[model samples]
Target: MSATLPNGSVLSLATTYGAAIPMTVLTNAAPPVATATAHGLTNGDILEVTSGWLGLDARPARVAGSTTNNFNLEGHDTADTTKYPVGSGLGSVRKVLTWTQISQVMDPATSGGEQRFVNWNYLEDGNASERSKPTNRSAKVLTLKLADDPAQPWNAVLAAADAAGTPRILRLALPGGSFLYYNVYVGFDPEPSLSFNNIMQLTVTLNSAARFIRYAS
Candidate 1:
């Protein structure tokens, strides 16, 4: 029999534990157009920028608007000449989520997936690729099968309905006291298969865009 994690594993945003998301600064627009690539922030979302530009660090700002690859900060009307200056790298920008929100308990049948990339090698005297080599090891992903519960904390994510702007972090603890963390985009599973009076079921795919950091008990 295959062992699996129980349904009680927690899925909470990183902000809940005061962790911040790291973002790369692509444009140093004036206050009216502070820009970063793929920020994953929604309008009115609170953000804290740190460690890139001195002017932006350690300040609480609100997002005015954002596209899939860009975001503009609200109320910052000045630009810094040294903004993202030479030798300066990216900063950390975290979208603050409701830390106090309850976590949604996933139903059974939730499955995990892995994406591994490998490359083949061949010798001039040999046929096709004689051997294979590992290229990249991606994060482990989980598909959450959730019973429809309008009162669940995940309901807020569903109601937001913003994909390009909002992303979250999920922390899952397995039966053996091991933990896995994933930064994911909660695509609104708007169309769940319907049944006759059975409890409604919705499936949300939590793609791990980053490394699956693990912790042991």
Candidate 2:
């Protein structure tokens, strides 16, 4: 068996996005096919999707089975019409063009994303027995503790993202060259923590807008 450490990992934030390509239609299928006239995306291109459907908006997806005018939203399931109504998923998609590394990261903690369930208890059944079904998964939140250095260029990047209040991509690169990418909105405490004999630090929170995407080396 092998183990990987987080010591050599790096975190980066998306800083630039390409021009938005208008998406005309999204089919209700296991993996939704998007229609964009003259879309030049390839099989493995990553796109930030914006849609009228709340479940699909602000989500980052990879392109698959691409054609000149259509591509699949890889791994996205929109087959349930109750959850994703037809004609409500129209929006635009943009390619993430650039990323800026966030340095001086001290400790990173992740929470939530647990599977939630709905429970039911029947009158005929014993009190000890109950039925349960899985519901929607919880969102993941990543909190990063970093040295409070105002001189760092990434500080401005964080501030700008927070001010914009838009969902952007956050990537965590592991030691083995694998990656976990999150679509998130940035927020942070403006005041730094003060402690004697230790360097000042601040906490930045990345609230996920959609499920994280993982890529192998």
Candidate 3:
């Protein structure tokens, strides 16, 4: 989920966690306890305890449970044995923009429906960083803050069989990848639906102008 920290700083699920632990992906209540804002604990975020492994209101740990659960930082899928191995389910698309910036991107949309989806430019999070080790470099994950506007909110675990209602699919298009994996919270069978309730991922592609407007009135 997306939430602005106490410092008025936008903090997504993408944070620094020195170790591994259980990450609680809550779908019902996002506003959180410590703060008043509705925060969404989602991809591109990390969770850990500062005092021990799970502390209350401690550093390096955001109050309440959102992205705090037994994690698999290796970038593996617990179910997908073929694709995402066990040791490769950690880390995901990085946050690219903040909530305020995203608001600007949404201002141009004409339809309240389309406006909810990638109606705004899918500002990428995470960026490549200079490798600390010799002959090694990494990407710097930017901070992204996407919200479930009142217009729409996806709430359900999706599956291949689920094609009736059509849910807003949140896909992370990596720069260099043949296949794209939409962010699935609950997972297949118990497949997690999109964020918006009314919108489902449309296979039909969107034109340049339909997706992004270089100049908006």
Number of the top TM-score candidate: 2
- Name the TM-score of candidate 3: 0.17
* Candidate 2 TM-score over all chains jointly: 0.79
- TM-scores of the candidates are 0.49, 0.79, 0.17
Per-model lDDT: 0.55, 0.88, 0.24
* Candidate rank order under lDDT: 2, 1, 3
* Candidate 3 displacement at residue 74 in angstroms: 17
Model 2 lDDT per residue over 91-173, tens place? 99998888899888987898988999999988878776789999987888899999998888788889899999988898888
RMSD of each: 11.6, 3.3, 21.6
Highest-scoring model, lDDT: 2
Backbone clashes in model 2, listed as residue pairs: none
Cα lDDT, model 1, residue 79: 46
> Per-residue alpha-carbon lDDT of model 3 for 37-90, expressed as tens digits?
223444343223211111111212223233333222222212433432333222
Which regions in candidate 2 have their CA more than 4 angstroms from the true location?
28-31, 42-44, 52-55, 79-88, 115-138
Better of 1 and 3 by lDDT: 1
lDDT score of model 2?
0.88
Candidate 1 yields a Cα-based lDDT of 0.55
